[model samples]
Target: MADLVSERASEAKEITRRTALERGAGVAAVGAASALAAALSSSSAAAAVPGAKAQDTSSHSRGTTLPTVVAGVRIPDSQLTRAVTEFARKVSSESLFNHVMRTYLYGSLMFDRRGIRYDREFAFVAAVLHDLGLVKAYQTPNERFEVDGADAARNFLRGRHMPAERVEVVWDAIALHTNVGIASRKRPEIGMVSAGSGLDLTGNGLQQIPADALTEILAAFPRAGFTQDALDTILSLCRTKPMSVLMHPFAEVGRRHLSDFQVPTVEDLLLAAPFEE
Candidate 1:
């Protein structure tokens, strides 16, 4: 059956991507109490999927002085693996969460390769820290919501010797991550700017959020911080992020194995049940 073949293809593609994450997660897990480890643990909810294997435990805490965080090598944990998992779940693991993260890394790497001059640091940090606002929102009042993401990123970036300016860029990007084309006002260590939040479950590419939900998110970022151009650019990438797996036009950007399954729409997204926690 056509459906059978499509599912097989989707699964095969997913396996290829997951293998990449297993190797990378192995690298991230090498650190003791590292961002990578914390991030991986946080995604315990997503790891509930059947047959998900543990990353090789050897790499992370292998008795190192300072963990190795290189240009291409990404140690996903908090802002990273977790964020990517959230995106995959929002789409019902349509692309297999691990595979989606792998694809995202590929996209980011491609962007960097194409003289984008970006670093995986921002992308990794932004991804891990992006949804931190959600955690903050649950703990704080709605007015404190938007500030939560930025505040968390600001706090985490501090001890790492992240330059004041670059930290500022990441903070701003996190604050308005839900919006689109935010420039990382903060100086980047690897010249890679922090793209905004990867929080959209629907992938509508919104960074500023709808005016109604703006109260919590906007509490940190004033209305003036909203930038239409930045928001649009982010949306464009998020939109094109799933052409291969999502059955969309730009899916040509990657190989979307959507023969058996189609990407969820806003309607399908709404029908999904609330997470019980």
Candidate 2:
């Protein structure tokens, strides 16, 4: 009896570990697997997951596999569209825009953390719009934007019939998702999935940025116009944010559905991590 209790206690201690790295792997893998199963099980069920509406799956080009969208629910609410439009208008500059884009892209592919249905949907939508404050702060990298952005998102969500509690998840994911290195009491699936895949969204830790001989993509194609501006903006952003490499992985995986657009980046294949030794 004592031996069994000791064995159980040992297992309990091991399970009780709050190691940040372990948390990252567990949350990411579990979230990814759960989404995959849902995608296979039912499209409507899959559609219920949070942040499930990102059009950018190109970030999954890294070794990670993205689940298929079963239910195919695109976030088409008019209120959500207005909110997203407002946020998009606020974004400018290559670096900041790419960071927001990649965060949504890779965060969706990697984590898609969904806890409660309404909150999950609302928070994910908020994540998509989290960086609008940057437009107000082109002069200063003020921390105030974090608070402001969260507030803006909360108002938009609450106005959309999203409950108040769910608004906080949106607030928190928008506010804290960037700090992937520091341990958090609660980790967002979006951050863990992006970080666990080593895709690097915030550009916080890295030794080298991924390479992009995106020459094939930079030029205008005969069939469709070249996205020179988008490509240029992305490249410019790449110089600064190493996690932007997640773009590479995204493009490769989400090809046909995302063609003509230069693949986001096949970042998962890169050998060097941007983290400095």
Candidate 3:
């Protein structure tokens, strides 16, 4: 018994140590990206057209048009957008961050192909932050990972003083991104977020994008072992927070990857109720 206890303690220490290292790496990457963005913003301002229409000069505006357009999709370039990107970088592993970026770009391409009108910035924000629950910084012990991510995104936007209605849209987009039928029936932005992420994870809508555009998108954000990394992250969450995965599909991940996973199934809960019926 004493040997078993010591082994468990050692395992716990290792998990904590690895988590700390991952977070440290994320922060370092964020810092480098921020410095590069600032330098590029300054250079763009210096080379601006002499008499172009004045851009929004608010704190949210970057005041320069450094080319953020990638693969015919224009990624919004503003102070607020940069902040959103930087925050994701700080909280997410590189593979996960790249996955979110691909999610946005893939969704944007689909929107363009279908001639669907939507708010680009809102969609981008929702897409990038959709997996926040999977990251250590935004995870909660009890909520479904989707809800945790949505709540985190909502709080972040509200802290920025975004309007309630707009914030709600983003919340729905993130929260329902995994709910296939329901999400697709909601507002356009919500549907796009779900569809985009679904495409990246499962190739559900690969036929919607042309081969050339897909090539370009992948080139910009290489998968970089995203599939295995994502699986490990999910399995980690399942191990640490079994309750959070109880009613969600993540329960299956726990069952498959975790030898000790014993969370009750929906049917188990239903049949085990105290009622005499």
Candidate 4:
């Protein structure tokens, strides 16, 4: 028992050390991307016409303009939205980044179809940052991936000086994004984040989107083997933090992928509770 405990402790320390190293390496890249995003935001604001709707024109590289409309859904181009996009692009893997963009677009189309009103910027930010926890830099050793991503998004928005209430909403949207039943019952923005991400992953609402629109969205953001990549990412977290996956769907991923994965079931915990009866 002592040996087992020591081994697990060593594993935890190794995960933490590796995560710190990865984050340190990523810091420089994130800083450069953020600086450029800030400059673009400034330039766009300066070039804007009074009372004109903001257009999606931010670019990561010279001579490239991000599309303003994808499948008839207008992408938000506010300063904050631009920053969120740039940050997600820099931090997320290509497959994960594409998944989030599709999540936002799919959710937006669903909102339009259902005649549901939602804040585009809020929903977009939530969707883009929803999977941040799955990234090495954002992953935490103890928290569920969803909560880790939620906390990261909250910190990012708070750094940008977003309003408190709005920040909370985004946090909820990201944190509860995986809990379809609960999230779909919350605010329209929150529900859209869940609905959108779920649709992208599971295609539960694929029929809601038109065939042409689906084709256009897929063309704009290719899946790039999102299913396999996403699964592998989740399994990575499971291997590192088996305890964190307990009571979550990620536990199943660990069970299927990790031969040595072992987490106590709810019934086990109940029976072991401090009760003499």
Best by TM-score: 4
Sorted by TM-score (best first), the order is: 4, 3, 2, 1
Which lDDT tens digits does candidate 2 get at residues 82-160? 4453444233333333334333333343333333122334434654555543333221222233334455566556666
**Candidate 1: which stretches are off by over 4 Å?**
1-110, 136-138, 183-200, 203-277
> In lDDT terms, which candidate is top?
4
| Alpha-carbon local distance difference test for all models | 0.34, 0.34, 0.64, 0.66
Model 4 ranges off by over 4 Å: 1-63
lDDT, model 3, position 11: 37
- Please provide TM-scores, in order, for all candidate models, with all chains considered together: 0.34, 0.37, 0.74, 0.77
Per-residue error at 8 for model 2, in Å?
52
Decoy 1 TM-score against native: 0.34
CA displacement after TM-score superposition, residue 225 of candidate 3 (Å)? 0.7
Clashing pairs in 4: none
Which 10 consecutive positions of candidate 1 have the poorest summed lDDT? 29-38
Instruction: Supply candidate 4's per-residue lDDT for 46.
Output: 13
Worst 10 residues of 4 by lDDT: 32-41
